[model samples]
Target: MTDKAGIHPKYFEYCYVAFVAFLLLSNIAATKLIEVPTPWTNLVFDGGAILFPLTYILGDVLTEVYGLARARKTIITGFALSILASLTFWLVQLAPPAADWHNQEAFEAVLGFVPRIVAASLGGFVVGQLLNSVVLARMKQRWGEKNMWTRLIGSTLVGEGADSLVFCTIAYYGIITGGTFLNYLIVGWAYKVAVEVVLLPLTYAVIGAIKRAEPAYSPQAWAQREAVRAAR
Candidate 1:
């Protein structure tokens, strides 16, 4: 922990809360596809890509303000929450549908995740999120805790890379052609990184403002306890 230990600012806590919210929403939204036509080719990406990069921004703030251990806990919290969400979806889908319910087919179409894909998502989240927090914490230690863009984008490169490779490989490897799989990997990762790059200014502003406004009451342990509570 930094010398600023024991101080958990109010706005900073809100940031942490927002981080987890974005992460959960992003993962749930990722089940859908969004396609667009570029000048040279048509590109397909998940809607979640737009929001997932915000998690990176939150990771940067946590590492910069609270330190790595806390960020590590936060990452773990996210991973556990994601798994729970997946399981909840699975359970809900498994429960018998009402006789009058007419949206069973549509609901299954939207959320009927295969076991392999679920495993891939959970695994990728653990590896990628940990790497992201670790890398950001290390960079912050070396770089004097400034340069939001460098840390945010740098960590995203590593984190999103792990996430993309694991997700694409395990979830769609045999289902998609090698060429198409590679394309999905590239576009998915690239799109997420681009979100970070584009939000550099906003990230800087948010970090700066929060740092100035929030009191330094560290919630390193409290955050962990809350995460565990949510998981259970």
Candidate 2:
């Protein structure tokens, strides 16, 4: 009978697509390593770092608005899609090249990396996304309708730390050892958390707008409003 959740057709559907898009893109991007400079030093990170943090943010939005059950469903969907994407790439990599096709090596150099990286990402993602969603959902459970930022930031801190550690370890543990390997863990985790913190204002705005426009945000809120109306 009515349109919902701002200009979006269905916020959950939009969020889910965006979540999986970023997830798959980040996995592909992660095949290459990059260095970020600070006045103190240069930090090594994967290309995926640029886009991966947004997944957690989107995860938060899904949890905060639609609740944990649906958020987890979305995470599983993204996870399954990521596996599908990796398998698709692997299949392409295995296919025999045409006699004139000379880019098979290039294809192996690039898309061939997808299976391993995507596998590592999948491991870390399931662990981290679940942690992030559980933390936010639990916080919302306790605080009711207040203190959104606390839960969002807190969850990111927990989720990103675990995700970065698992991913870096799986992706580069034996390949890059000692201080450099450890640096990957710290930098990746800290960078993700920093991105989440820096974007808190925007996060607040998005969540607020969604809550206002989406009627199903909180069953308790809806119940209380209906109770007040009954009194009137």
For model 2, what is the C-alpha lDDT against the true structure?
0.87
Query: How big is the positional error of residue 107 in model 1, measured in Å on the Cα after superposition?
Result: 1.4
Tens-place lDDT per residue, model 1, 1-232, is 2232344446555766777888778766766767688898777666667777778778877777767777777777777777787788888889999999989888787777534445676677778878888888788778875575788888989998998888777766786666666777899899878877887888788777776665553365557556667878
**Candidate 2 lDDT tens digits, 1-232:** 1222222324678888899899999999999988778898779899999899999999999998887887898899989999999999999989999999999999998889888898889989999999999999999999987999999999999999889888998887787888888778898999899999999999889988888776554575567656667878
lDDT of each: 0.74, 0.87
TM-score of decoy 1:
0.83
Residues forming the 10-long window of minimal summed lDDT in candidate 1: 1-10
lDDT of 1 at 125: 72
Q: Which stretches of candidate 2 lie over 4 Å from their true place?
A: 1-9, 217-221, 224-232
Which lDDT value does model 1 have at 158?
Answer: 97
TM for every model, in the order presented, reads 0.83, 0.89
